[model samples]
Target: MGDLVYFLNGRKAEKIEAVTFADLRMQESDIEEILRSSIDMICDDEESMLIVGQQVKNEKNGRSDLTAIDNNGNIVLIEIKRDRKDIEGRKEAFEFQAIRYAASYATLESTEDLVKKVYAPYIEKYRSEFELGVLTSYELLIRKLNEFLRVNKAGKSFNKKQKIVLVASDFDEQTLSAVSWLNSNHVDMSCYKLTPFKVNDEIYLQTEKVLPVTNYEDYYVNLMDKSLATIVKRNKGGTRRTLPKIDSMLDWGVVKEGDVIAVKDRDNEGILLANGNIMVNDKEKSMQSWLKEIYGWSSVQTYVFAIHKESGKSLSQIREEYMTQQAMEASDDF
Candidate 1:
């Protein structure tokens, strides 16, 4: 008879020689190895480009683990845990150890040094499948780390924000709660569960839940949608201010004064006297309301009439001239 037998996923139970659960939990490295092997499945379709190593030591703190880089040259710090033991507690060990590793390589400057130090020994000493894997991982980490550092120095930090990653088989309530709390507080991080299952005596690693990277702030989705829509709108039209400008005009009462606005007509022979005075086409009502808010409507009308009288042209003619001038100026940019 086999040592142990258990129903797996409630599908046609099979009895076989069971590896001791204690043996599985005994060596932390074994669990780490499983995760290291499972990374391909874990990182699939995620921002992660290439995973460098499982337990990358941080030179600065002398204590750290998983480090990776994404396709866009962003750094990802990972921490792995199998289960709880008597030493320092499981979740605590995973969290703090990863944080220490993350802190060591938190900024771009330190990440490069850490990458080299962790990979150099492996690159020099080994010659096998694992060694080749390490080499490939090192190359990825170095390339991205260098590129990320270069971009950071050039003020591209927003696009290269670091991601702290945690991978584990099981997390206790405390660990999950802590993670959720950190996420709520706007920490840039994510957690993944790695599970190993046996089918016909062959072990296979599977990736479970991939947690949200960060918490949702008020109007965050709306703001992101607005930003993407603005970019698309810009590519489509040569003359469209963003939705934000319209928003500001309505919400903040900011007068819509372009640097050199354009109002166009069929004729192109006149000077653009009404260039700076033009606002958005739809803001006339709210703009007039603002004018009334600041000064009376009669004052605004008088001012408008005075501008026309002084220029010796109708408002329409002034606008057409302004648009013609703007058309000429816009062509100069190309």
Candidate 2:
């Protein structure tokens, strides 16, 4: 649980203090919050759902950082790095090292072969349990992913989510951004941003959405001030270019082409999107319903129709056009 609090400068900052996952196990109550938040990012999609952290163990060989058991009962390798050191130099190298560890251990022709070859005293400790759990304060995400693939037999299946997550007080911006960009290309993988905050001298952890939430279409729309498509497109680039038309800009499943979305009435003003989430000046039916159904049609349709005809193109298309026009005028700031 993260809370927002004023710092010495009255600015906000998460209070991690001396907490570090390397010294704590996932089962610890304090680490549970970080695990919950970080796991959300790793399990953002289906492939990631079956893959989890602390399910892997790493040999003391100093070569491998962590190890995990994939769904298929195979081995997955991992490496942890949290330093700002130039030794590793490249992020991809860390990922590749884990792959290499798995590759080496993968030479076993079968489960029996794996037992005879890679399974050491330590690995055998958890062999009967059929899973390994490892945590490094740095980043064990690479292991999380490898373990997921092994557990799920990813390549053999058409499944798409790659489960992996890195938990830290503040991770490297480059790695975070890269992981984010990669996450957008597929739903199988995701990342989470955990900001620890202290409010009234109490530390709380807050979970922020990093990927586009399909269910809360309106909520995200309002939060990001962009249409669902725009949000999805920016994160997950795909060929599904179904932009909405002008009149259907306010219709469900449509983008209004504007960068920002706002809802207003006589008394209060609020911002909105397709998801049922919002930020409003006041909580009122006029405001709540409008925010909840920001892209929906109702009595408001009459006014919209008076301005623009249905034309049989579906409300989505019409709304898209209108939104696009507004979006263009608003610029890309919002």
Candidate 3:
């Protein structure tokens, strides 16, 4: 890592020195506490990851740093360490320790089990931050989990898998190598590097997700840019990305109202309406909802799954053609 510099003026700059947590005399507990309250530091609006509990104890007679449930209802184990020494000095490999903790979550039989075991305590611990009405902590936990699942339309896949996230200021080479192998072998694991910087007496931290997470829901994939649908068989490089909505397709003139769309090999079809909803059985639904239902998944690439009957092509193909044409025209302008 390099220095973090801030420009006070066009010609003047202030260079902030990179510092270790030890340099600032900060304990790993401090980092855990911050992350327990601010998991968003490692996440963005595109994804949802709610930290449910911190220092959660497991049957293994050890306590996990933090636990979260992602939008797709996978319990995420987040373990934090200060540096390379902290990660490698453990009796077990850091990754192995986290994997053991995560394996314990796989035994959860139902969402209710999750509520009773993990989230209920979180509600009580953070009671002041929430508005708990005439309900017990367990009820509040259920409400929170259900509401999160309902809002993201992820109820169907609640707790289907467990994911591990390891955070440390510095990771040893072997740990990263092992994590890479695990991810390739279909283990949902990620490493996030959290570095600290110091300026005068103030210390600041930066977080970055080190490995690109593999797409869990790879039922559909779009090889094109965006705003359309395409389908291909799953392969090793199935990375999930942001997909464009029907509004973008309409803007690009890929498809318009009165057009018919259907999922591959499905006889029943739906009609695209002017308001960007698909009409099925006289009921209107958003393309995302339709796709999710068809795929029976919490996260589905909608545009890829939808086929435009008029063009006999995927909206992905149409959008790809339009982008290519636009790019060619733009080049001719030069």
Candidate 4:
């Protein structure tokens, strides 16, 4: 891992030296406690996950650091290690420990068992966080979990798969190799490198996904777009163009509010609204939520799957047609 660098006072570049957990006198328990409630440190915002259990125990009585239910209806086992030796020195590999707990979670078949085994114990451990005045029975817990699954729109795909996430300050060679091999065989496993850097009295952490190299094309495009926006800000009387959103589609006359959208190859339909949420089965759901729920995909491209009932054209097609007409009207290269 490289030292994290940042601009000091927006004037000179400064290196924030990396430090081990031992140097900070922090233990694995400290990191586990912090991540239990803040799963976003490892997960992206779009991939919704709820931490239903912390220190979840397996059949062998091994306690997992965290257990979560992801939006894709997969049970997620998140295991964290403080430093490199915290993982490499173990008899059983750190990754194997997480995999064992994840396998135990796979044996669960119903939401009731989930509520009893995970959610109930989690609620017990974090009682102050909930408003359970006289509602501490299993009935209430099961009901609440069911409601959560339904409201999240994950009910249809509940327990379809299991996901494994391993986090550490640094990874060992064996751990990296195993995770890569598992991913190649279609196992939904990932690793996150969480490095801590100390700057004076303050400590900051940098997180990176080091395995299964993904395309960063969109990330770079966003950086270039930010640069263009900065140029616009500096130029007098120049304004930055915003990314096209649902409102943009309405303005471009591609689709209107209250238009019915039919999901391709599916019987599902929704009534589009100005706010970008669609009315699906008497409930307002975001276009992306509807798409993700039906497809059981981790991410969704709303416009690609949605078709305007009246025009009989997919949202992507209509958007492209509108852009083509605009380009033809302008007929000039920038």
| Pairs that clash in candidate 1 | 263-323
Q: What is the TM-score of each candidate against the true structure?
A: 0.46, 0.32, 0.65, 0.65
Selected candidate, larger TM-score, 1 vs 4? 4
lDDT of 2: 0.36
Model 1 agreement with the true structure over 151-253: per-residue lDDT tens digits: 2242244225566767765554445445556567666566665555555656655554434422323212343244532332233221111112233322322
Stretches of candidate 2 exceeding 4 Å from the true structure: 1-41, 45-60, 63-65, 69-99, 105-109, 113-165, 176-192, 199-334
Q: Tell me how far the alpha carbon of residue 260 in candidate 3 is from the true structure, in angstroms, after superposition.
A: 31
TM-score of the candidate numbered 2? 0.32
Model 3 off-target regions past 4 Å? 1-10, 213-334
lDDT of 2 by residue, 136-225 (tens): 311233343444344345534322112333333333434433444444555222333445544454655554434333332322324434
For residue 26, give model 2's deviation from the true position in Å: 12
Clashes of 4: 0
Better of 2 and 4 by TM-score: 4
Q: What are the per-model C-alpha RMSD values against the true structure? A: 22.9, 16.6, 12.4, 11.3
TM-score attained by model 1:
0.46
lDDT per residue as tens, model 4, 1-334: 4446674767877766688878999999988887775566676534556677888888789998888887667898888999888887899988778888888998989988898888898888777766677776577677766755664578988888998989888876667667767776788887787888887888787876665434212112232244532332233221111226677889876788899999866788999998878998899998876875775433344565688999888787888888898888888654
How many clashing pairs per prediction, in order?
1, 48, 4, 0
Error of 1 at 4 (Å): 17
Q: For candidate 3, lDDT tens digit of each residue in 206-282?
A: 77665544542332223443321121112234233334556777877778988999875567699999888999999
